[model samples]
Target: MSDEDLRLSADRVLARLVGDPTDSARLREDQWRAIEALVAERRRALVVQRTGWGKSAVYFVATALLRERGSGPTVIVSPLLALMRNQVDAAARAGIRARTINSANTEEWDTIQAEVAAGEVDVLLVSPERLNNPDFRDQVLPQLAAATGLLVVDEAHCISDWGHDFRPDYRRLRTMLADLPQGVPVLATTATANARVTADVAEQLGTGEGTGRALVLRGPLDRESLRLGVLPLPDAAHRLAWLADHLDELPGSGIIYTLTVAAAEEVTAFLRQRGHTVASYTGKTENADRQQAEEDLLANRVKALVATSALGMGFDKPDLGFVVHLGSPSSPIAYYQQVGRAGRGVEHAEVLLLPGREDEAIWRYFASLAFPPEEQVRRTLDVLAASDRPVSLPALEPQVELRRSRLEIMLKVLDVDGAVRRVRGGWTATGQPWAYDAERYAWVARQRETEQQAMREYATTADCRMEFLRRQLDDEKAAPCGRCDNCAGVRFTTEVSAASLDAARGELGRPGVEVEPRRMWPTGLPAVGVDLKGRIPADEQAAPGRALGRLSDIGWGNRLRPLLAPQSPDAPVPDDVAGAVVTVLADWAKGPGGWASGAPDAPDRPVGVVTIASRTRPQLIGSLGERIATVGRLPLLGSVAYHDGEIDTRVPRTNSAQRLRALHGALTVPPPLAAALAEAGGPVLLVDDLADTGWTLAVASRLLRRSGAAGVFPLVLAVQG
Candidate 1:
């Protein structure tokens, strides 16, 4: 078709996409250019436009035109389930039959795949993670790639490790891109890539060596409707209180982003108590709850959805009037993408940043989960190479020191690098030569540090906040956005009501997070030389326990994180923390299921106290044990001793299997401690500075129980969520 004829057809499709046949919703010139490239030129393209710039329109219109010409379905690789849902609904409005095959709708996979095979589906939306699934990658992906007419990679920044939100699964797209049929058109798009990331993604899209390189369509990253501001508060309490006091004063219902899931729940609860309608959305939220939360927010049924990054990327609500961050994101690029959720189809929207002292701690925690070192990566490859059959992740965990999540990520990256391949049963070594990219990994780490420093500057910069963020993304047209608080004079108040502040403090100040005991042993413990498997014996199991606070909590967490940090000095518990521990114990004793609750199921009161022998924080643990024993008038039974007085430092930060293996014969109930336990005659309080993975607590509790203690009640200063 001629350009003029294509433009006329695309215009009508655009009107249908907007749900108004009578509305003259013609595609913008850039959007038209993109469609023209994909349909007329049959060329690859990268559209780096700002959010709500109608990137989706280019693809939807292209899909309609392609299907009209009897081309195969358009397969879009989206990053989030929320994004896929919005696109599916939007496609329906354009009279295109859209279907999705994601983790959430596994039951419909067969039907959806059949429909696509039969050419009954015009668009198929898939998640990036699906690209690496064993069955999907080996069985479905090739077929889809061969037949796909127009391939769209949404949020393409994820394909580059330099991108703020890189995922290993996204990089797997290279193989699919390289294998595409000749003349097949591909389009990659994102709103948060700087020059480096854009170049990297474009290079990946150029895998078809003989084909012309991807056309790059870059635009300015500025949101005129967003009125940016920063409200620096005293602490988490004040920041949360400010939200409670002034949330209604903000434009329309919108998101309030938190740095952690604990904070999300905390904020949602406090906001609801303050008479605001709110819901929490986090990675841990069930798919049904997430879908419901999105619906409620889109329909304005709830004032806001207190969310984490789980709600970011591709949640489409054009009239969203505000985007507030309770704590600043670690990168300014990330911050821009999140705030871009607001003011898409409206004249005005509020974007406020309430930076907290705890932001750095949260950032550091996430940073720690980055790709493992060269040694660990090599070890994983060696293990997989030695395996005769495909080894499942659980079976592989004992041999690898990395945690499950981290290990999965490493395997995905290796799979993409051709060192390993995920197979029917599990993963297998491909016997391919794989060299560790130490320099590249180091560069990425340094880039992360630089981004973190830039985020710090963003929070305190006196210049235009939008310009600062735009420049972070290498936007050449970045200038002072006159709508920001700094550019337009401060627009939001830092003041909050005394009652709301107190309520927030009280809510956050309340201590005690439940620490559930480990009920089952880590899989493949025997492979690590530990004689353990299946369910932990009931008699050996520790009862549900309590910690003073979560390290991720907004209130007590802020106080406990420093005290429990790995580098923190081994000092005795501070008075304020001790006092909070006492308050928690008192509340626990009188609350349901407590020893002093007077309920039928409540356990007998503690008769003694025992401490976990800490290799690093002996002073803290020893003093805490004595303090608790003295306060309860109970005997201070000696600590659980390390075997032969030797410590296993490797047990502190490892996966469950490795930790348990190192701990299997590493801890013992010495005769003195056992005798003391026998004399105590009843349950003893187990004291530790922190509980992570719960393996240490379980081992120590079992030692005490077998040594004649009636029961174990574990207590800790902090818990890792």
Candidate 2:
């Protein structure tokens, strides 16, 4: 690792670039100087170049220099598939013997590996996720290690937790390169990196103190060809409407970003409905669909694309004339990356954001979901630690016992938190378990919060939007671009007041109405009879006399019976009896399982009953109760409850049985629903009567919690005791 040994005197590396006849692109003087310095210094170097500054050219130049001097093959590790593809394509266009390894070419990866090993491949582009493969590391990497070559890491900022787009897998690359010879140099390049990120990249690459060099090339972040605009939209719908109105004005190649898949679908649907051809991309999208959509956009078959942040990184659609964020992003880095997609071909472009009052709230939710609470971190770590080998999503789901949706969100959160690392096929723990600092987590959380706040300010402030962005990038002395929303003739207006924004509200609750018993009357009887006959509306049956008579005749306690009961004229129930009913309801609300709820002898048996309150034969409730009983039979069963009618059937019906039947028809279990619930880290039982309205017993346990059900084992059945 001496200075003399580190120097890139290898002329063959330089020849690899300049020797290629197709490499017509020339490096700028500053880029050349940086390249010369890296070659002479022979140490790990950080090259921070501006967008379109041809940072790739410097690497190519150095590669040419090394090739001329008979250096070994060069390997470039990239985080983006599209970026890797683009780099490989560029090298091929330059007549360099370059090959790439990514998810798209599994069958060819082994051949590519052999080629690299035999020294037939000069440059190799791969993703960090691919490095975890035992075959790649054990068989393929050793060959690359033996060759006299350089390792180039692209988008190196991903190594830093503080970096806008942090990737935990990037941290493992240091160990991956540990076996390389001491004299071999490593070069890292990025378009954007603050001092903190720079230091992090160097440290993660194991470029020890004074052994690494950083070059921060100054360039204008300002793009005069790009017109910045901000619109104050009340919601996503309005933003879509605005886009529709301006669709004709927008260029054919452009991108529209939404915060979520639902939003992306909605906007894409709205645009297509209005006669604009659009493609969409999101995590839920199938691989084929994603590729088709991307291809459609790239081929100009689709005039525009509505996507989430998934569209960034590797996408190289340089002809894009505009980039519009349906809402504000969680960070300035995200905003810059998204906006950078535009004007890449040196043509005029436009970037717009429809800022709303809830933008900050929306961004905060995304951030929080991305960086979950400490408990979640512990859970993820535990799950990873328990695994004997790397496991895919399907294999891990049952072990963690969480719903797929919930687990996926938590995984993404853990990824952003840097507590866990996801490789190509599986995940593993990263750093020390205690390495997750609360202060750093809080800072990132606050930074996300601040970016959202800044969006609000940008939308409402009289100053230029471009200037605000520049200041965010640490160019505080930069002047206004004089071409943004504020620079134009637009006037600032505050539609929402500070008080309204600051007002605290309850967290999002479950999405349905709760069903409570009509009267407060406790039944001393051990058995209750259920009537499956007529529609019993909550308001119509809220009478004390009717409820008491039914309770008195049903013999309510432990046994269940089904029978039709006519309305009876009875006196009002006593206050003491009513108070007893309240106590029972409270107990039901508290549910049957918890640390305070004493352990039962028969742990696998149902602990409580759920009676569905309906006038007709409580078939829906009966069927649901049976399912709950089955769930209670689970080894770890804690509680059980059933609803009498199809609580989920949103339709109103006068005939109870028909309504119940209809409800059953509507309650089909979603495929991913069971997986998601299992991942929630609990065992649950769902109950209902007749399984009618079909919704009550089908993933009802999970839905209840989602809808803000305060207690577990809440039941719905068609009987009264």
Candidate 3:
């Protein structure tokens, strides 16, 4: 086709994409180059551009043109459910049919697949996770690879481990790429890949070694419409106060980004109490609720959605007025990506960061969950290899000490590395020799540390905040963005009122979070030599417990976290902490379903007190027990003892089954305490410093019940999630 003819053809597609007349919509030069590579040249391409830079337009346009030429349906590997929904809608505006097969719509997948087979679908969207499904991989993916006209990897940075949001499921795309028929052009798209991540993703996009000469289209990472600033808050209370005071002043309905689920919920509650209409969006939210929250945000029905990274990547709200971070993300690349969500479809949008003192601690906590050490990896492999049958995750947990989430992550990595295969029943060892990539993993960790430092620099730098973030992404053209606070001076007041501050302080200082009792024991305990399995007998279980605060909460948790952190010297419980515990008890006595609530099912007041002896925090736990017993005048039964004085330190075990083993016979009730339990014949306050895996309380509660207690009421200083 002649160049002018191609330009006119692209213009018509652009018009459809934007719902404008053909002459009013035209592709930029760089966008045209990307189109040429994908359509005319049939070449692989990686387009690294900023948000609102028409990356989607390029793909949708290409899809329309390709479908017109009688190509097979375009397969798009999208990351989030939100992203898939938005893309499907955009494809429709461009007059292209798009169907998605994701976890949210299991019932419609068969119909969607049939439509694709019948050539009724122009584009198909599938999440990275779906690529690993046994049925899809065995039946659908092979046929799709052979017939797919073009493969699009949305948020392709996920393919690189170096990327801030690397997903192992995305790495599974390698097998799909290798299976694609020759000349099936592939396109990788993202707005946040730094140089290392870009190179990594480009390398993976290749169908073969020499043939992988992808057309790389790089664009400047600058948001002309965003005005950036950072305010260093002294504490969480001050930060919450600042948001509560100034949230209504921001432009349009926006988002408040928090670092933890507890923080998200806390912020949402505080804002609502302050009369702001907001909702919480986190990984814990149900799909239906998440959809409603997204819709509310999109329609401006609410002021904002207080969300974690769960609301990120592809939530489409053009003219979103502002984005405020309650705490900064660990990496500048990630921060830049998140803030980019603002100012995309508006003339000007506000981007502010209220970094808290607890931010680094949260960062370190997350870093601790990164890829495990070589020994741990090898131990997992050994467990899988020892068994002849495929082992389900629940069944494998008893044999390995990793938590369910982390263990699942490790298995996915192993699956990608060809060390294991996820079959119909579960996972099986492939018997293929696998070598640990120590150097590579170490490099990724170090890179993370470096990125964390860069974010710190971005927060404190006197230079333009946008320029600092741009430099972190290795955008060589980065320059001073005059719209930021550093370049234009502070545009908003950081000062908050004494009343607001006091209100926030009161809310945060008020402590006590309900900790639901574990009903079912970790699955697969029998395989590891433990007798416990299935639903914990109701008779042997602990009643729902109460903790002063969650270890990740922005409130009292901050005060408790440092004292309980590793290597901290043991000390007596502080006076204020003791008072808070008393307050918690008083509230427990008077709160709903409490002993005073008069509900028939309410648990009876704990008649006697029992303390779980802590190996490291013995002084703290002992003081807590003594003070509570002294104040309430309840008899203090001699404490449960770790047999042989060998304490089962909660730090070493990462998962439930391991903790159960370490605690099984690790605690024995003193004969006097057992006798006291029989005499009291009512619930006892089980005092402990912390509850990590909850196995200690479960086992202890079981023992106390067998000794004749009516119920166990657990009260802990903190709940470590």
Candidate 4:
């Protein structure tokens, strides 16, 4: 075709994509170059462009062009569900039929597969994890690979370990790439990758034997519209108060990012209490609820969605007015990726960071869950090889000494490396020898440390914030953008009113969070000699309890952090904290989700108090129980003693099964306590300083039930969620 003809076809696609042929939506020259390389030359290409720079348009146009020329459907491998949804909707505007196959809509997978095979689907969006799903990988992936016209890896930086949000499932893309037919084009796109990640992903794009030279089109990693600033708050309460005061001042509906799910929920609740319309989006959020929250934010039905990183990378609202962070992310790359959500389609979007003292602590907590030692990986392989059967994740949890989340992460990495294979029932050893790369993981961890330091610098730097961030991403053209606080002077203020501050202090200082009892026993307990399985009997289970606060909550969490933090010396419950506990008790008696707030009927109030013996914080636990007993005028029943002193429950910090093993027969009800409980003939308030895994509480509750306590009402200073 002639150049004019090509330009006309492109413009027509762009118009369709934008849902307006006369909007004059034209592609940038770089975008056209990416499309031409993918469509005409059928070469591998990587596009490292800023957000809202028409990266999606390049792929959509390439798909249209490839389809017009009778190539098979484009398969887009994306990392997030929100992104998949956004892509589907965006594709529809361009008259491109897009179907997604993700975990949320498993029932529609068959239909989506049929549509793709029948040539009715223009763009097929699938999560990277789908590549490892037994049914999808075995039954559908092969056919999809053979028929795929163009393969697009969205957020392709995730394919590299150097990427801040690296996902192991993305590594499976290499197998798909190798399976594709000759001369098929492949495109990888990311806005967050530094030079190292880009080079690594580019190598993956070069994996196809018949694929020719790869084209790398990298643009300046700078957003002129974002005005970045950092407000260094003294504590979580002040940070939250600032938000409550200034949320109305932010231009449009946007996201409020928190570091943890609990933080997200807590912030959402606090914001709503402050009379702002908002919702929470985190990994724990139900898929349907998450979809609704995304819609609510997109439609401006809510002022903001208080969210964790779960809301990052795929929810699109071109006119997002602002982005705020409650805590600093561990790295500048990840931080930039999140703040990029703002000022995408609109000019002059406000981006603010309220960095807290707790930010580094949260960062350290995440750092601890990184890749495990080589021995643990070997142990996992040994167990899987010895099993001679596919061992599900739950079953594997008992045999492997790793925490569930970290273990699953390891298993996924192993699966991608061909060291293990996920099958019908679960995962099995692949009999492929794999050497653990200690140096790589160590390097990644070190990189994380460096990035964290950089984030600290980014927060306090006198230089331009955007320039600092761009430099962190290794942008060669990095220069002061003169738009951030350092360049333009403090743009967002930290000022908050006394009334607002008082409200925040009251909210944060007011202790007591609902401590949900564990309903079901973890599976595979029998393997660990615990003999427990299925649901815990209601008669033996601890009732829904109360805690002074969550360890992740911005309010009480800040106060509790120092007191309950690791290496902190244990002593009697401090006077102010004990007073807070008194406040918590007073509120718990009438609190919405607390013990006395039962819906069908008013729940039984504690008639007696019983302390759980603590090895680490005996004084704290003992004093807390005495205070509750003294304040409530209830009998202080003698404590539950450690019958088997051989085991330390928190030593390994293992999974549920192992935790149960540690707690099995570990507690003994004192004879006097047992007598007091029988005499009281009512619910007993069980006190402890911290509830980490709830197994200790579970074990204690079981003993209390066996010893004839009418009900076990477990209470704690902090509940780790």
Q: Candidates' lDDT values, in order?
A: 0.91, 0.56, 0.89, 0.87
Q: Which residue pairs collide, candidate 4?
A: 512-548
Residues 332-382 of candidate 4 have per-residue lDDT tens digits of 999999999998888799999988877887888899889889888999899
The TM-score ranking, best first, is 1, 3, 4, 2
Each model's TM-score, in the order given?
A: 0.99, 0.63, 0.98, 0.96
lDDT of 1 by residue, 1-721 (tens): 7889999999999999998758688888899999999998889999999999999999999999988998899999998999999999999999999999898999999999999999999999999989988889989999998999999999999999999999999988999999999988999999999999999999899888566888999999998899999888999889888998999898888999999999999899999999999999999999999999999999999989999999889899999999999998998889999999999999999999998888899999999998899989999988988989999999999888889999999899999899999888899999989999989989999999999999889888999989999999999999999888888999877898999999999999998988899999998988878888999898888988999999988898899888888788888888888888888788888999999999998999999889988789899999988988888888898999898888877673658888887788889998999988888788989999888889999999988889898889899999987
lDDT of 4: 0.87
Q: Predictions ranked by lDDT, top down?
A: 1, 3, 4, 2
For each candidate in turn, give its C-alpha RMSD to the true structure in angstroms.
Answer: 1.0, 16.9, 1.2, 2.1
What does candidate 3's lDDT look like per residue over 309-388, in tens digits? 99879888888999999988999888888888888889999999988778888999899889999898888889889888
Q: For residue 219, what is the lDDT in candidate 1?
A: 90
Looking at model 3, report the run of 10 residues with the lowest lDDT sum.
Answer: 644-653
Q: Of the candidates numbered 2 and 3, which has the greater TM-score value?
A: 3
Instruction: Give the top-scoring candidate (lDDT).
Output: 1
